[model samples]
Target: MALTGAGMSTASGIPDYRGPTGSQRKGSPMRYEEFLHDPEGRRRYWARSYVGWWQIATARPNAAHAAVADLQRSGAVGAVVTQNVDGLHQAAGSGRVLELHGTLARVVCLDCGAVVPRVQMDRRLRSANPGFAEAAESVADELRVNPDGDVDLPEDLVASFVVVPCPVCEVGTLKPDVVYFGEPVPKDRVERAYDLLELAPALLVLGSSLTVMSGYRFVRAAVRRGQPVAVVTDGATRADGDPVLKVAAPVQELLPQLVSDLASQPDDDSAEPAEALAASR
Candidate 1:
């Protein structure tokens, strides 16, 4: 099953990327081209992402992540395709997670392509800006991981912020490996996820809008393959009318109950759980 976007981690206190209460400004986050071309933009991006890492590091998976992992453990789920960079699913004990967007907890040097643990940069950030670590930890819960490892901070407080350079290449800047808007998911990653989807009998979507083409493409692929597509989310999604089963509820609240209900069904298999739920209503 594929769980797209930040909503999967919303219950864990991380905000969504773009929703009524999303973390973006003007309904958008920083773009890749802007980060590359604008020095000030890059500075701000890195600054905020650095602070946001505190939250990312501390966030634990919520019930939804656990329930999905339970499905994986039972072999009812083959894989979890996710767009989030937070790596919470693995923390939640999920075994077969396909992180479509790269992890936020690591850094990649643009010049040499040497990967470094995010902890190294965090220590550097603390050492470079003495009291900034305290300030970052204080506001960590609200911070969102930006294009680079920088996070968003209040504008008034940004004046005290400083962007740290890559330790490997003093000249080159470091950027998080996450897939930004307009950046295509690496061809190999997409292909691997597609291959996994082929193994599952049904596609279960949770807490995603599927607003981006990267995610919507999967929903389309499932439909074309004649697989049952079920969605559990709060608001309207690209899959709204197309899904075989639509559960308009918060995933953290619905998933465990749904799993329990399915577990209690008759062993004769006279009725499908989805059909029974549909009839009960």
Candidate 2:
């Protein structure tokens, strides 16, 4: 099984939280409790997301994503579990991807539980706030967008921004379908990931720091089960000492070569994992 994180999509221009450059935005991300309890927080989230959503919605899959898909096609990788919500792995043609966090491509009504495509919500926001996008673009030249489509904007701008309710429910708050800080990953998702991990001979981690337990717990589980683990990332990770093989390199530069080397080897499985890991190094 393969596990990926925000760094997996960084090559496509989305920034990861707690990376070398740190968070791109000024304030902390919206916590689930805050988002649910505070009307002002919800308004602020939707306002920034209204403008920043375009960045995530438009991002394309990079070489790392393609390489993973190729590895899967070659039977070197069986399943993928990702902490990222960007849907880039699916865009790259990977079939059995499990999104640990929910996707940004969807929005769900807090009250009604009705789900809608993010593009449709974008249209609704645009229709409700006339000229808002144009005005925001002009002033947001210095703002940085995150993978979850959050951006830093002035308080005054956020105040001026308008938020729309769910069209179906009419009373519920609408939020991107992602697991926020202070929110729990649904039980079923966790179970499904564990099931995949059980079947995998080894765990291959790509482009993740595993700083949050949400993504890190799986690594811990794998290690406890005596599964051989390999990690490919550019910087320090929580699982640094746990992996049987740890390679510090950019995924975009490393994955294609690993895929090529694996493809060239014999169809036999015995020598493949070690040979591929050594060749990648």
Candidate 3:
């Protein structure tokens, strides 16, 4: 069973992109082409994204991630397919993770497709936006508000922030490895996730609303093939009614208990541990 999106990472203090109280009041990030064509839009995105990148990088894996890893280790989960670019799942020790979105831990040049570690971009942002750096530190307290992951800040602060261009090619466009709003999921990555789905009869949706078609497509694929689906997240989902089980709760609290209960179950070679875990949760 694969877990996807922000809900799974909420425990790590990362904000959900969209939900009842998301920053944009809608789910999902900006589109790739928009960033390319709109210079100021790019500036605004990079501003929030640059400071937000620190939180993304420094975030530790929470219980949900650890529990997922434990389930994988115990042979309860065959594989994990994630829509998140955050590397928390891998950091938590889950193997065979199919990253549906490219990782935020890396950068890719759109023109050449050459990838560089995310640290390079971080360094560049720091150098280019020293004023933003000072303002970011001053607003650190304001940034951490909305304990439930909803953050509100001044628009001017966001607008004044600068976005640095690619270091390799001054004219070359750079983007995070993550899939954007309108971009299609890479064909090979989708195929690989489908291959993993074959090993298990259930798809476990975690911490995501599944609003984006790139992710909803996988859930749709699983349902079409008669695989039972179970979801755990904080609010409404694209698959809300269809899943065999739906738990609208914070994943951090639920996942640990689910992992423990599933791990304690009797070893039955013929039994479906994924189903058992899903039912238990």
Whose lDDT is greatest here? 2
Q: List clashing residue pairs in candidate 1.
A: 46-150, 48-150, 48-151, 48-152, 49-149, 49-150, 49-151, 50-149, 50-150, 50-151
Q: Can you write out model 2's per-residue Cα lDDT over 156-199, one digit (the tens) per residue?
A: 88888888999897978898899999999999999999999999
User: RMSD of each candidate?
Assistant: 3.4, 1.8, 3.5
Listed per model in order, the count of residue pairs whose N, CA or C atoms clash below 3 Å is: 10, 0, 1
Give the Å error, residue 109, model 3: 1.3
TM-score of each: 0.86, 0.95, 0.85
Candidate 1 — which residues are off by over 4 angstroms? 20-27, 134-160, 266-281
Q: Which runs in model 2 stand beyond 4 Å of their true positions?
A: 20-26, 267-270
Candidates ranked by lDDT: 2, 3, 1
lDDT of each residue in 174-229, candidate 1, tens digit only? 77777876677999999988898888787878788787788778889989999888
Q: Candidate 3's residue-wise lDDT over 36-88, tens digit each?
A: 78877667666767766776778899999998899788776778888877789
Weakest ten-residue segment in model 2 by summed lDDT: 18-27
For model 2, what is the alpha-carbon lDDT of residue 94? 99
Clashing pairs in 2: none
lDDT of model number 2: 0.87
